[model samples]
Target chain A: MAARAARFNQQVLIDTTPLPDSIPKVKEIGATSAPLLSAAFFIGARCKPYNDDYMMCKTEANGRGELECMKEGRRVTRCAASVIADVNTHCLSEFRKHWMCLENWNQQLWQCRRFERDLNKCVFENLKLEKVIPGAPADEIPVHLRKRQIYAHSYANM
Target chain B: MPQDMPPVGGYEPIQYKRNLPARGFRPAYYLLAVAGIMTYGFYKYGKGVRELNELGREKMWSRIHLIPALQAEEDRDQVRRMLADKARERELLGAETKVYHSDRFVRPTFAVVPENTTD
Candidate 1:
């Protein structure tokens, strides 16, 4: 009986885990980008330095050995932890902007761009990360494509 | 033989005693057992009903349907076309366009920074 009950609970959870189809916007971005978008939601001043350092390692270092950028990578992880903790405390209202944006904009990143920008802006400013340029695109747009464009342009010039 | 037959008529039949062990519990104990089983059954049924009702309520409350991570073929093609168009636009621009969008960035609602941070 206990085993049966466990199976029932698992099925219920599985049912709840997927995004609903009513929001076509989420369906449009589909599954591939959802995790990235979700991660993007939490980024702010707390994680900026690490994110910047990692980007520098990736782009300037040309994807070489991370032996040079290990410190930055570690800093990013540490910053992420503290930043996540801080968000759970001070910036809940700002954080809610993303939630509200998800519901209001139907999970469209482009539409929620303002809310994400607002969240990161609010959270990071509180962490004193405002003046520094973010390594990742602070906007809702995909940063990888932009990076690729730069790479492609540079190759063409060469 | 005639004497034995005569003795038989005078002989009485011997009476035999039967012994049986007493029951440890009273009849009321059986009644209590039945009642306890019924109560357990009813409690389980009530819990099942409550769980079912909660599941129904959740279904009613959910506004969005669950969309799987996989996209439809047409949707995937659409995304590909959009990417290609963006790439073409970038190529035409020659210089990299720093601005991804025209939306004005919103300010943060909270501004209390933690100390010991380098700029």
Candidate 2:
């Protein structure tokens, strides 16, 4: 039986060992892709500084940044996870609606603009985290704020 | 041919011409209309592509910004495992032995999972 199981076992040794007691523990964010994408802008809005710091640490540490930047990394994780938690708490229905729409629409933002609007508004109002597409054209409205979506799967949402 | 005669105006001048007016727009007008439609379609297509590209950019940057933190998390677990394995090896063998031929530092990305069940 063990031989058969071993023959069939596909699990690679991506170890699950936790950080030791000397290192401060940070809980991993468990949200999957759709939910994460739905909350990504807000996470960026709230965690930009921490994220930049972590990236800087990684860049400065050369290849060894992976080990050297754990502290900055933990901060970034906590900030992002906190943003997700706050959005989950304050805008559960809107968040669900947007991500579910995202899941249904091949994760296309165009298809779920209405639900995203609701989520963006909710996150901004409740969590004070605004979704601004960085480096967007200044002369025109951002693509996300457009009233018409030419490529949407459904126009009713628009 | 039973003396068939012209009933009215010599059978309307034999009625050879297809007098039915051509339907729809004239060729030039229709071509212009089609060209207009295609141009508009291409314009809209361009806009959609541009929008999609911008969205892709946003998604990419988001992931890029996310890498450091996520990498750090994985590295922490890896370092912990390496330390734990080293401690265990020391306890079992009374001293640490090199597992690699080189003296240079090389981080192993994975380990062989120990099998506990006896076949």
Candidate 3:
């Protein structure tokens, strides 16, 4: 009876009734495990920069660098590129670099609220995960999942 | 007797009178001159008021925008000075200070001068 109750609790936890509103309609309709995993990954990446201390620290440092040296302002562009590359490579070192780039970007954004707004607008408008990531395709993924991924990429640099 | 009576009857008293010169359209001429002066005065005053108002508006606009820019510039200068002082202190202590670039948002062309250090 104890084993049966544990199994029931497990089943209850896995029940899909209380899904978030932000999750796309397509993800809900098809109800495939792959789409769910992808959505989770996208959300995780978007929220990563905000929560990670290392990324925040690096972002602050990068903001300082931009303030000090005008020439080094291009460092921001390079850092952003590096972050995208890291996402593609999926290497641990690349991941660390990606986080650092995000940290820098966030620092700059915080310093200038206008920059933050502009960056957010750009990400929201131009986010194409399938185009940025070679293997991914827009049609295969749910719309909310794509949005989450875009938000993640956008904030990743911040 | 007839001659005395005729002289008495014919004699009459003559009074002296002086004739003044006519002043033609004096009041009309004075009115026209005053009107012309008044019209010129109003035009000049209106023009002056308009120019003054424009200048005041321009000044107000400049003040509104200039204050913030001046404050930011002063803050930046102060920060630079403080950094310079810190660099001097490090030099006096013979410490190796790492120059960390601040990622503050400013124009892309501005360059900050680093403080002088011995080591």
Candidate 4:
């Protein structure tokens, strides 16, 4: 029975052995990370010369009379206002996408860490039980462990 | 004949004839009129006083009720700020990593020892 219990303990230890690289490290996304890289590429592709007429007017008015300066200022102000509005709209849209991505990443990381912790805890508990089994009282053995012992005995009989 | 009717003793000419009655009222009628006017005045004055009292009470109650509500609103704002700060702290500490354990049963002493021990 001692040998049998030792064998069962060994099996439990083997089953509860920690996996290599068990805990997943938190992932940090740098500037060169996929999400940021893709966002940059998307922005570069979507961006265009939005106020060509205003630019032309300013270029034509450069180093000219007072009337030209006034004209250039008006064109610049109008163009700036429109560009600001357009940028704000684009930023709002992109912000929502970025927020969702960050939220999803955070959730995934949380779940992964929780799973790793649970697995570690289970392994630790099994190790503790195996270490304590030799001095454990015969009648005081827990039902779950007793059931495992019974299963082992029956298997040995088979 | 055109004769001069000039009596030596009473030479009086009756010129005006009174047709309307006297303008003075009887005592009972005058008293009733005066009482009616006084009753109307008193009714108006009493109604005005009651309405003013009601308005004053309403204003006082409104002020009494408003102060607590405003104070409660301020207290709620403070509580909201406190909760916001706590939430910020939790966020910074990564609340998801927190462990929750409930230990219900006391672990058996023998279960924690080896059977090979003499004791």
User: Against the true structure, whose lDDT is highest?
Assistant: 2
Worst 10 residues of 4 chain B by lDDT: B110-119
lDDT at position B23, candidate 2: 90
Question: Relative to the unseen true structure, what is the C-alpha lDDT of residue B5 in candidate 3, on a scale of 0 to 100?
Answer: 61
Q: What would the per-residue lDDT of candidate 1 be over residues A11-62, giving only the tens digit for each residue?
A: 2221112222332222132222333233342443335455655656646766
Candidate number of the best DockQ: 2
lDDT at residue A49 of model 4 (Cα atoms): 29
Q: Candidate 1: lDDT of A97?
A: 64
Q: Write the per-residue lDDT of candidate 2 for residues A39-115, one digit (tens) a residue.
A: 88888788889988887887787757666788888898898889888988899999999999989999888789999
Question: Over 4 Å off in model 3, which ranges?
Answer: A1-158, B1-18, B93-119
Question: Model 2 segments beyond 4 Å from truth?
Answer: A1-6, A10-16, B1-31, B99-103, B109-119
- Going through the candidates in order, the fraction of native interface contacts each one reproduces equals 0.00, 0.36, 0.00, 0.00
Worst 10 residues of 2 chain A by lDDT: A6-15
Go through the candidates in order and give the clash count of each.
7, 0, 15, 5
Candidate 3 per-residue lDDT over residues B1-119, each given as its tens digit: 43536564686766566667867778889899999999999998885565444334433432332222222233334444444544555667678444547653344342233332222
Query: Candidate 4: where is the Cα deviation over 4 Å?
Result: A1-158, B1-13, B16-19, B23-35, B62-66, B78-119
Winning candidate number (TM-score): 2
Candidate 1 backbone collisions, by pair: A19-B66, A19-B67, A20-B65, A20-B66, A21-B65, A45-A124, A122-B108
RMSD of each: 26.0, 6.0, 29.3, 40.0
